[model samples]
Target chain A: MKIHENCEILSLYIDGRLDPSLKKEVDVHLLSCAECREITDRMKAAGKMLSSLEPLTAPPCLEKDVMDSLESRRSFSFIRMAPAAALFMLLVILVSYSLILPGKRNEKLTSGQNLLENEGTPPAVSGDGLPGAGSLKAPEGTSAKATTEEEERLVSGRNLMARIDNDDIKAELKDRPADRVPAASSAPALKVEEMKRCETEQGVREPEERVGMDAAGKKERPDTGASSTREKMGDMKVENRESEERMLPYISSPSKSKAALPEAEPALAGTKESGSPSPLVISNRKDFTMLWNLQNASGGLTCKLPDIDFNRQMVIAIPSNAGKTGYYIVDTVEKEDGIVVQYREMPIRDPAPTPYQIRVVNRKPGVELQKVE
Target chain B: MEKKALFEGIVREEKDKVFNLAYRLCGDFHQAHDITQETFMRAYGSFERFEGRSQLFTYLYRIACNVWKNSLRKKSFSSFTSYRLDDREIDPPAREPSPYESMRSEDRCRMVQKCLDSLPARERAIIVLRDIEGRTYEEIASILGCRLGTVKSRLARARKSLSEKVLPFMEVAGK
Candidate 1:
């Protein structure tokens, strides 16, 4: 580097500004170049003089004064921002809550309905009974579009049942037909076994027997009076309203079902006693009305079976002849272990009984009907 | 941490550097104190935005330079140079001095400060930052918000000018 060019390096070098390689280069250059040496010495002296200048001390009170001013300004700023922050937080909460509530309700409605389409049965109970109860729990086997009104009714009824004292419950259970108490004990397994039987029988049952087994079996059946099945159903509904108030207290737990199971067994064991071929058979559809004691007196058909206690009755009516139908229900019969309620495709309210459609609703949550395939 | 406590910590650590930069740039003790206060006040107002991209002292120095530059715009360089000769003789020799010796030292300091003030603002900033404040060229470039080459060239020009202006004083002292 020439004298003029080296002067830049000289100043940079004196200020420790040059890179090491350049500083060393300048150092070698300075040892030989008198003119560069003179310039470097002068630059060194000038840098020392300036760096030696005293640094000023800030006043002791300077920080306190500045901070006080800053605090006052910040308080004013916070006052301005407060309303906007509050409004933003409120909007976020409102938006989140609005978004969340319907999801919970829809979640309750949807979860179990899908299982009905897939499995054709009420969903099995999961741990939290409330959510599981909503699954496929519809009346008349129509899709589970149970109205909020029904939900509210179910909730209130459950609350009422919860209030029943244990003594009251036991007394109420005791008051039920002694034979029916064993049937209730046999309920869960009996339902499963009956459902399996019905599924098998559904394939083998002839069209004529499917219509009305009294016509096909040629067995005598007592005709239910008046052919006013609609009015009878209406009467049953009214009775259900009355009986549900009484039944709700006793039906909350499965302990009753387990207790009743052994008693129902002997009824099964005595199948030969009836000597009726299929001892559990209420195969004659006209005899179905005998299950509820709605048969005519003149017909001389006796409903001689011991009366049973149950939570609700399902009336399944299938069309048979024009404007005439057969009503079928789960018929409870004595069995070996206990009594069993058989759910078959029996017709009610119509004589033709074709297409084999059945409608059922058990208003009690705990006492769900076993789907016969 | 409370805003006051945070700001106080930064002030405690870098207050002298800020004050010295202000004093050196404007050559007025009162004005330097005022500028230092204003610099910290501005830093507090935007402290939330200070994302710590640079060192704290470097950031504070940038603010101090701007404050000093703004003060220069309001008052001319000649007025600042007039205040340069005072009781504050800038880290004078440690040995005790007679009145005449103190006066001579003050005169020399004033001469050096006058030479620094003669340079343009950009060059003056580089010289004060690099030569007086002993900041590296990279730091000088950062504080003045300029490229390293700009710091190098302007520093060279400021040094040339300073040497020319103070040469007569140095010669007189040499005799």
Candidate 2:
């Protein structure tokens, strides 16, 4: 065999692993080849040096360490419990995220022109409030059935009010100071003062021209019947319609009376043509009585709630649509035309019926709302 | 015997073998202790799956080698540092001067280990299992899970590499 090929067998020969036939050839070659012989001697010496390495006795405490670790592992099975711990963390994150998301959504609604954009829409209901009821004036039929359905909705809304106290609403309003209408100027008794404001603004109608006008019998004021009135009223209608496109009709509490009301009038008067069948405008006066103008055929109404004493507050539950109601807190602000009593809407949890009740509760500042069980 | 008892018996029987292999592989007693502990822990976790196809000690030695490799990877040695062997001394510096005989034995051992550490991990393991542990070729083949022919070729290469490293020192000492 060649010297290089014999060199390969030299290691196996040192390890005593070479077959007998190969060993004999390698042994005979080793005698003749100095290079191969030197390789064999070197491999053996290296193996002997490696063998001479002292075997280190494992530290005596090693057994204890290993055994204790195993014992403790029985108590805390990280491998077995890791998945459960991960699942628990995931649940906590989900619940916290869900709770935080709605508050953020509400805060977003009140930011910038969002407050102006959502004016006159149902306050707490999300995008496109009062679905299918767009731009349509309130029913001229205060039929017994409509009134009854309205009452049923009011009851449901009241139940919802009991569940969702004013705390969340207060938190939402904390940032919206400009949207509040100052109560000292515009606060008035509901039925009488709202009638006076209406009469003073329109000048065409007498306060004696009561509600309950049917579509056919509706009287068109002679001057308002002119095309100019129709054209101006149509423009106001279009503006109010556009503003309500993003409406969340949120109302602030009486406690927020010092805050300025957002400049978000739905142009109820401008949209009111004397002869049109508009939504029944219920102007809530200071004394808690309602004034309904059956002739105002606009999508929104304005109400002046009472100037609540610091110790007393009012909760006005109004059925907004089929599935939701708006809880309005009476915060009044005065304008050049008259006292514009504005209701800041509290977010309703569910939809309810109309004729939402006016409940005046004596509550001290920082006291919790009494839960109506 | 109950499985727990059987497992404990196996651990008692094989702990030294696994520890020795780990010590030779990493050349640090404390690190070898850690490696040995981890190997047995892994073996215990998978003890039920062990079918005894190979000797229990060989199976455990394989685990020790794997743990040692994983430890090296976690340290993230730069490729250059990994390739440049002899960075780790087999023994820590002596607290005091030792007798000449013991120091000589330690120097020889360190030289042998330095040469072993220079080889790639696979070849180093082959050298350790075959030469240092004195396992037969058949035993190493089963332990490494390679063919007998492969084991022989690898062993030959590893020995040849070690000789190149250590023979120079031996020749210098002889002179």
Candidate 3:
């Protein structure tokens, strides 16, 4: 093969890698060709200059930052962990609350979902005002024992009265105002934790020690024998149920003239205090998210929003008309629609027939007639 | 680049070998250490995408070579154009002193380092690995993953160009 000028055979020739005859051929060429000799001389000079090129020395502790970035400084901790803790705590609260103080929030959610699901569009069940959820129905083909029917109605009635209570709980939950603090934000917390880990790791410790401690922190924090997150979750659920009860419809009426009818008494409020939602048009999810945005709505509040299963006009019995009168019911179902709840207001305080209901009612004067439940 | 088997095999057999190569190449212990770490991290990061067709060491060495080149690029020493601007016009802003300079040779080395910095990372890398470091064409070809002919041409060109730039200051030992 004819050797090209840039052929690596020149390199091979220098390393003595060519075959003996080839080396001899190269050697003879080197003697005759001054141009070839110049090339060889330049090659050697280039090699010497490169080897003689100075080496850069690293400053001490330079490896620390790299190690820091690698070890505990990435978001793997929070992404893999914090939510798991929060979720675990939330589950624990639900399980424990189930055991300690029995409440029907789940049942209410299930039934509402059931109404949304199996009921195939049942008539509108409105719990405007009453202690027990006076979810009036044609029984919707649910052949529950009379007791179960009674229970569901009562529970739903409570949920409606407690509807404001849900808002109140939301108000309470938001009370912490932790939202303004960057550390409380989901992604920020992870970032903060990673930064802290980086600082801790890079601060003068041996690499092995830093790694060991990080591994230990991961194990200890997320999964040590102490699974308290679950218990915290359980407690949160209990608080949620309590808040749910607070929002239930209960009082007989606002004025004291008529005594509360015996039948409308919700078990929780022996002596009742009450509230209501306005009949204003809510345009969309924004309004609902706002409703969820409440004072006292704390302890990891989450909601499975009603798909607002049915939309029909039913007068919800106002057991305790304890809110500002201008407050009309705002339809958050199917977006916010301002609907007038036309009810005959015979201002009275005593409860009568059906105890409480959500429908047009005829009333005797001085006796506050509520939409019968 | 026979990416998987290359990675698996190299990761298993020559992590230290390549790391040593990087350490020697950069001439700074910690940077070398870091270059090794980053090289492996990159190798591992893209390990899943490796499709095996080339030798493992060759594949990893290619990655290492690219990585070192990148480091050069990051320092804004990408071309002779930038080199002239920084050297002739911009005084190197005040720098924190390093602890290791001990000899005139080192100071001379630092001066030459300025010249090396003037070259793009690709050229300097070719010269260092091929000429000074004395890597064989197959090994350099294997490391760089180029055709042997391309390696030869790059080696010759890299040496000729580096020689022209670095020759003025040094005392050459007459052979």
Model number with the top TM-score: 2
TM-score of chain A of each: 0.22, 0.31, 0.26
Report the lDDT tens digits of candidate 1 across residue range A77-169.
898999999999999999997788545433322331221122222222212221111221223333323344333322221110111122222
Point out the higher-scoring one by TM-score: 2 or 3: 2
Per-residue lDDT tens digits for candidate 1, residues B87-154, read 46444234556889777866776787677767788778888888778888889888889898888878
What is candidate 1's TM-score for chain B alone?
A: 0.81
My TM-score estimates for the predictions, one after another, are: 0.41, 0.47, 0.39
Tell me the tens digit of each residue's lDDT in model 2 across A43-68.
Answer: 88888888877765565667777777
Q: What is the TM-score of chain B alone in each candidate?
A: 0.81, 0.77, 0.55
**Scoring each candidate complex against the real one, what DockQ results?**
0.31, 0.40, 0.14
Off by over 4 Å in 2: A1-5, A69-373, B1-8, B76-104, B145-147, B168-175
When 1 and 2 are scored with TM-score, the better candidate is: 2
Query: Can you write out model 3's per-residue Cα lDDT over B38-133, one digit (the tens) per residue?
Result: 776676667676676766666667787878767766853232232221233432212334545334444555555565656655556666676555
lDDT of 3 by residue, A26-52 (tens): 888878877667666766766776676
Task: Report each candidate's C-alpha RMSD, comma-separated, in the order given.
Answer: 20.0, 17.6, 21.9
| CAPRI grade, predicted model 2 | acceptable
